[model samples]
Target: MPTITIKNIPEELYEALKSTAENHHRSINSEVIIRLEQALLPRLKTPKDKLTNIQRLRAQISPNVISADDIDDIINNGRA
Candidate 1:
């Protein structure tokens, strides 16, 4: 396994990581690895991609108006 070394981490971040490690009963090394995974693994979608997805989903669903009476009816009757 390749060893990684990080330097010049801020004191506040270092203290927070230490506290998080203690809270989760993890070693500093394990906590760092988990933090790295959580930080790096999510693929951020672009605004255009998000808008396209919303438009596609909206196209598939029919638009309908829900009146206050309809909402009250559903709340009272437990059915729509």
Candidate 2:
């Protein structure tokens, strides 16, 4: 196993990492390794796969419950 040292981590970031490690019952080093793996490795999804997921989620929503006007109003309200 290789050992490395990280220098000059921001106080807030270090605290956040420490808190997350404690919450998940892991040591800081383990938490860092898990986070690094997630950052470096990602799952590849095809366009068809993504579209299928979108369609599945959209199918769960009831039809005609909210009108287009309601959606527009919701969007405009957020801008004010």
Candidate 3:
């Protein structure tokens, strides 16, 4: 395996990476590898597949009850 050293990373970004690594109970190197793999992998989902997933997720949650007013409020806030 070849090792590489990256220099001149911004302090904020390095800190964020360190924080994320700590949150996941991984070393910075391991977390970086995992993130790189996720970024590189292809996730091919069709519109139908996405809809099916949404439906499945909704089904998994019991008694999904959000009022129309709540929906309207969310839309209004997003528009503002």
| Number of the predicted model whose TM-score against the real structure is largest | 3
Q: Write the per-residue lDDT of candidate 2 for residues 1-80, one digit (tens) a residue.
A: 99999999999999999999999999999999999988898768999999999999999999999999999999999999
Which stretches of candidate 1 lie above 4 Å from their native place? 43-80
Instruction: In model 3, state the lDDT of residue 35.
Output: 88
RMSD of 2: 5.2
Instruction: State each candidate's clash count.
Output: 0, 0, 0
Tens-digit lDDT string for candidate 1 (1-80) = 88999899999999999999999999989999998888998768999999999999999986667878988988989853
RMSD of each: 7.9, 5.2, 5.9
TM-score of candidate 2 relative to the true fold:
0.55
Each model's C-alpha lDDT? Answer: 0.91, 0.97, 0.92
Query: Which candidate, 1 or 2, has the higher TM-score?
Result: 2
**Model 3, total clashes:** 0
Residue clash pairs of candidate 1: none
Off by over 4 Å in 3: 46-52, 64-80
When summed lDDT is taken over every stretch of 10 residues in candidate 1, the lowest stretch is 62-71
Model 3, poorest ten-residue lDDT window?
58-67
